[model samples]
Target: MKKNILSALLVMAFGFANAQGTGSRFGIKAGVNFPNTSSDFHENENLIGYQVGIFSEIKTDERFGIQPELIYSTHKVENKFIKEGIAYNNDVKLSYLNLPILAKYFVTQGLSVQAGPQIGFLMKAEENGINITDHVKTIDLGLSFGLGYNFLQDCSVDLRYNLGLSNPIDFHVGDENYKIKNSLFSLVLGYKL
Candidate 1:
C-alpha cells in the first residue's frame, strides 16, 4: 500500500512537471457498492453498500485528467451459520472516509477509462455490541479501476471496482499478523460543475 501511494505521488508529480496548464472543476458523485470479504469463514457472504462524494478534477489535456475525491462510504458483510439445527445471521457494518486519486484516459468525447488507488480511514464499526477497535486498524488501502460515460452536459455514469490490498481487521484468534481481505464494486452517478 505504501508503495502504491508512492507510485501515485510520483506519477502525479511527473504529470505536473510536464503539464502546460491546469483547469479545475468540481463535481458530485454517488455510488452503490457490493462488498465481500475474503476469508475462510466469510467467503460465501456478499454485502451491499454505497458511497457519496465530491471531487475536484484537474485536467491536463483532452485525453488525460486527475481527479481527487473525498467520499463517505458504507460497507458490510452478512453471514449465516447453522448451530444446533438452527439458523443464525450476523452482520458487520463499517464506515470509512475514502480518498481516491484517479488518472483518466478519454477514448472518445463521451467515454473514458480510469484507474486509481484509494486510501480509506475507518471511522466506525459495530459487531454485536462489542467494541472491536483492537481487532481492526484505522487505515485501509485499495486499488480502483472503472469506466465512465459523460453526456454533453457533464453528467456521467461510472462503474468501478475497489480491491483491498490490506486487511482492515485482525480477525485471527491469537495471531496479530492475520488479516481479512475486503473488496467492493460500485456504480456511480456523477455531475461536473
Candidate 2:
C-alpha cells in the first residue's frame, strides 16, 4: 500500500513538472501548526506541531490560479481524564498526509485569498508512548481557507485554517453517541522554483 502511494506521488510530480511550461510553478514549504479538536470530552488542550510540503501552482490568468499541495502534518492534543479519583493526562500525537486543492483569487498584486477542500490520510497515531492507531478513523475530510502574500518574486508566506468536517472518532456512551473532529491553524513560509 505504501509503495502504491509513493508511485502515485511520483506520477503526479512528473505531471506537474510538465505543466510548468504552461504558466505553472513548483514550491516547497515548511510551517508551524497549532492544533486542537472538538469532542464530547470535557478537558482538552492544544499543542504545537509542524508540517512540510510541496505544491504546484497552475495559473489560469493573472487573477486566478489553482494550487495543489501534498503535505505531511503532525498534531498533538492533550486529553485530561479522571481515573478512579485521580486525574491523568494523555498526550495524543497524530500524523497525516494531507492533500489540498485550492482555488486562488488575487485581490491585489501580491495578495491572494484561497479556499479549498482537503483530504488527509492518517499516517500514525499515538498516546504517550503507546500506539493507538485503531482508535481513530484513517481518513479525514476538511476544508481550508487562507490568505497569502508573495514577495521578492520567489518567496511567500501564508496563514491558513483547516477545519475538519468529519469525525475521526466513533464511540457510544450509554445510549448516546459521541464524536471528535480535528482542526488547526498554520503559518508557513514557501520558496518557489
Candidate 3:
C-alpha cells in the first residue's frame, strides 16, 4: 500500500512538472507549524514545528487555479500530567513527507482561498528522544483549507489549517480504545522561481 501511494504521488508530481504552460509557476516555501493532537488518553499541548517544500501553481483561468506542494513537515506536542502522585512530562514529535493538492479561487487580485486533500507519509516518530515509530501508523489523511496572499510579484504568504481524518496511533487494549489524531495550523512564506 505504501508503495502504491508513493507511485501515485510520483506520477502526479511528474504530470504537474511537465505542465509548463502560460499560467504556471513554481515556487519554494517554508513554514511554521503550531502542532497539537486530539486524544482521549490525555490533553496535548501545542508545540512549534516547521516545514519546507516546493510547490507549483497551474492557473486554469483568471479566477481559478490548482496548486500542488510536496513538503517535509514536523509536528510536535507536549503533555504533562500527574497520575497516582507521580508527575510525568512527555513530548512527541512526528515527521512526514506531505503532499497537498489544492484548488484555489481568487476572490480578488492577490487574494485567494484554497481547499484541498493532503496525504502524509510518516518518516519518523519520537517520544522524549526515543524512537517510537513502530507504535504509530505510517500514513495520515487530512484536509487543508486556507487563505493565500500574493505580493511583490513573486512572494506569497499562506495561512492554513490541516484537519486530520485518520488516527495516527495504533494501540488498543482489549475492549478499550484510544482515539488520537494530529492537527496543525501553518503559517508559510513562499517565493516564486
Candidate 4:
C-alpha cells in the first residue's frame, strides 16, 4: 500500500516536471467496470463495478502522449465452488484506489491506442457475508490496454481491459492455499478541462 502510493507520487512528480513547454489537458472520467477472479476453488464470473476519476494528458508530440489518472474503482467477484459433490456460491466485493500511467499512440485523427500499468490499493473488502478485512491484501499490480476515440479535442470515450498480475487475497484456511485474482474491463466517458 505504501509502495503503491509512493510510486503514484513519483509518477505525478515526473508528469509535473514534463508539463513545462508541453500541451496538457486535465479531464474528468467516469466508467463502468466488469470484474472477475480466477482461482482453484472457483472459476471466473463477471460482476458489475464502476470508476470515477480525474486525469491529465501531456502531449509530447502530435502522435504520442502520456496520460496519468487517479481513480476510485469498485471490484467484485462471484463464483461457485464444488466440494464433495456439492456446490456453493460466494461473492466478494473490493474497493480500490487505482493509479494508471498510460502511453498513447494516435493511429488516426480521432482514434488512438493506449496501454499501461496500473497500481491499486485496496480500501475495503467483503466476502461471503463476513467482513474479511485482515484477509485482504492491499497492493495490486495490473496491465491495461485500451482503444479510444476523440470525438472532439477535449472529449473522448475509451474501452479498456485490466489484467491482474498479482493475487489480492491470502486465502489460508487451515493449510489451504486459495488465492483470488483481480481483473477488470471498463468503458469510460471522459471530458477534458
What is the TM-score of each predicted model, taking all chains together?
0.79, 0.90, 0.90, 0.87
User: Please, what are the lDDT tens digits per residue for candidate 2 over residues 104-153?
Assistant: 99999979999999988888988796998888888899999999999999
Ranking by TM-score: 3, 2, 4, 1
lDDT of 4 by residue, 1-193 (tens): 6776777767776776677457687789998998756776756576899999888888788999989998899977776776666677878888888988899999998798999998888888888768876777788899999998989678999999999999888665445677777887899999987
lDDT of 1 by residue, 1-193 (tens): 4564455456545554444355556789998988867754423477788899877667778998877777889877765655456565656778887878889898998788999998887767766555665557778899989998888667988888889999777653333243567788899998987
lDDT of 3: 0.86
lDDT of 1 at 142: 94
* Candidate 4 TM-score, C-alpha based: 0.87
For each predicted model, how many residue pairs clash, with residues at least 3 apart or on different chains? 0, 0, 0, 0
lDDT of each: 0.75, 0.86, 0.86, 0.83
Q: Which portions of model 4 show Cα errors greater than 4 Å?
A: 2-21, 85-87, 173-176
Error of 2 at 108 (Å): 0.5
By summed lDDT, the worst window of 10 consecutive residues in model 2 runs over 1-10
Stretches off by above 4 angstroms in model 1 are: 1-21, 80-89, 129-131, 173-178
Instruction: Flag the better candidate by TM-score, 1 or 4.
Output: 4
RMSD of each: 5.2, 2.3, 2.2, 2.4
lDDT of 3 by residue, 1-193 (tens): 4794577578567856675756588899998998757876555687899999989888889999989898999988886655556676778899998888999999999999999999898889998999999888888999999999999999999999999999997555455576678888999999999
